[model samples]
Target: MINADARWLRQARSRLRDADPVLARLIDDRPDFDPRAWMAQLPPMDLFGALLFQVAGQQLSVPATRRTLARIEELFDGRLPSAAELLNVEAGQLRAAGLSWRKVGTLRELAERIADGRIDPDGLSRLPDDEVIAELTAIPGIGPWTVQGALLIALRREDVVLPGDLALRKAVKAAYQLDHLPAEPEVLAIAEKWRPYRSLATSYLFSAAIEFSAAIEPAGAPTDAPLRERSTMAATRAGKGRPR
Candidate 1:
């Protein structure tokens, strides 16, 4: 299997630049951009930490996730708590750390499983993507989107795509000039051309969406909106959760 390391990024960039001209322009627009920069800002995480991060981030805006994670860190000396630490904390404490009760249950159960060897992180890293999805999603409140995030951020899989992510769907629509946000199946179809480099394509599309939003915004507009609010206000105002 191809490792999604620095060398993989170079290859992915070359392939992605060749596969789509519009995306190529987007990449060219930001010559020094690094897709992993955002991930770098996050606290270093193992499979367990990555899974918790994904769970914590579900349906929440990025800023909200950051705040929640920050609170969580404060509870554990500015680090993501290990499974034992998580299990030691009260559920109410976790809820106060910004997780919903549903998420609290999910996280606690996940911790329990991991702590007791019901799920093995090292073994999981060895599983195929489908098996990994199956294993993680068996726990309630954990779903495909969460698994997709872990696959990309934690496992560093080369060709992962998060079609269910609202931001991604929006990015795809805006990038491809589609009339509406592409459904998951359509997103998959469009992404077929980006195979083995879909993760890189996703990064470019996200960047393109940001640039498009900025370019089209009326000059002197308020710039204080948080990214998730700015990018997905319509969905949020409509009371929908931002997809993970």
Candidate 2:
């Protein structure tokens, strides 16, 4: 994973502080927050692995996603498969590992394209964000939200946001004190002020939402589920990758 330079992070924080009051308070309240801390729990992922993560996470909860990923890793001796390796595996193998038929097909198609040189994972990193989105979104089952999550997790793009994320929409409503949950467009409109540091801003809002959810949940209720859900929402929806 990429690490933002200390100076760069400071600058991003300062910019967000001036850009919006809610984020300003959020940033101030957590003086030593590490926005990327959640990633530590995830396995090391290449572009293909990240895409697999996004695909497996579709419409599933965080616990379910992790379980599926664990089974997939078990198939490869405890590691995410390379594109070639994935293509070598039968579709039924992935299905047995808990992936939906649609996800299995999507992953196989993506792996084939990458393995055959139709899609260049290395080259994608060098392209502008929009160009990368354009190229990847052309694939079946891969949408803007999926590509956006890959941009953040795989490429570490700084300015990306997931307006389509349901948890994020709820977080925006809570953070901004909106009476109703904001739609994708409204989320985008409000996030306009967070340009250039949106990923970081998004992390803050996600953290806040998770905390609030945990606080209100019954004492015996499962806590890690919600935490993981919110933490990975940038990559995945309500409990799945952003509801597409």
Candidate 3:
């Protein structure tokens, strides 16, 4: 399995390199980059836990998200709660952990669906990417972006790209020397060359953005307001829960 994965990655890398010169340089520059290395630092989470992470991150900075996640974990003994366990707790408890009422409601609804066999977390991996997105997005507050993050972090799907991600847009701007931040459709059009390796290509762009941010910012200086807004979400998707 490991060999097969390696072979597959090599093929993907070659294909991506041939399809776009920009991505070729990005891939060449980081020959040893492990796209999923950041996952090691996080606690083991199932599909529900992954969704919880994604949902918790919506519209919150990295530090705030981490704090919220920590508070939620403290309620359940320092780990994210399972779908059943989450449903067992009161919604007030989740709110107290810094989750908004909307997030709390979304999570509860998701947990209830899973608990009642309306959605099978385990079966999700067997379905195609679009199917998973469609199934999850049917629940309120669970949009394509949230499901896309789950696809990368939980399912490890190979071809996913988050065109709507602000950090990714910024990354694309910097990497491609665009005059302005590209919209979702523009990002998708640029990413067309990435094809089956969009996920891998995304990892490279995220790494570049993080590196560029660090290079430009001085120590102890506040991040630019716009970039700081979604940096945590991008970083979390990049790897560990911290900034990318």
Deviation in Å, model 2, residue 45 alpha carbon: 0.6
Kindly give the stretch of ten consecutive residues in candidate 3 with the minimal lDDT sum: 215-224
Model 2's TM-score against the true structure: 0.87
Off by over 4 Å in 3: 214-231, 237-244
| Ten-residue stretch with the least lDDT total in model 2 | 215-224
- Model 2 stretches astray by more than 4 angstroms: 1-4, 214-231, 234-244
Which residue pairs in model 3 clash with each other? Answer: 235-244
Global CA lDDT computed for model 3: 0.79
- Where does the lowest 10-residue lDDT sum fall in candidate 1? 215-224
**Candidates in descending lDDT order:** 3, 2, 1
TM-score head-to-head 1 vs 2, winner: 2
Candidate with more favorable, higher TM-score: 1 or 3: 3
Local distance difference test, each candidate: 0.71, 0.76, 0.79
Tens-digit lDDT track of model 2 for 1-244:
5455877888999999999999999999989887876666567888888888877776675667777888999999998999999988889999999988988989999998998899999999999899998999888888777777788888989998877766677788888888887877899999999998999998888777765652122121111122222234543321222222
- The alpha-carbon deviation from the true structure for residue 173 of candidate 1, after best TM-score superposition, in angstroms, is 0.7
- Order the candidates by TM-score, highest first — what do you get? 3, 2, 1
C-alpha lDDT (0 to 100) for residue 44 of candidate 2? 82
Total colliding residue pairs, candidate 1: 0
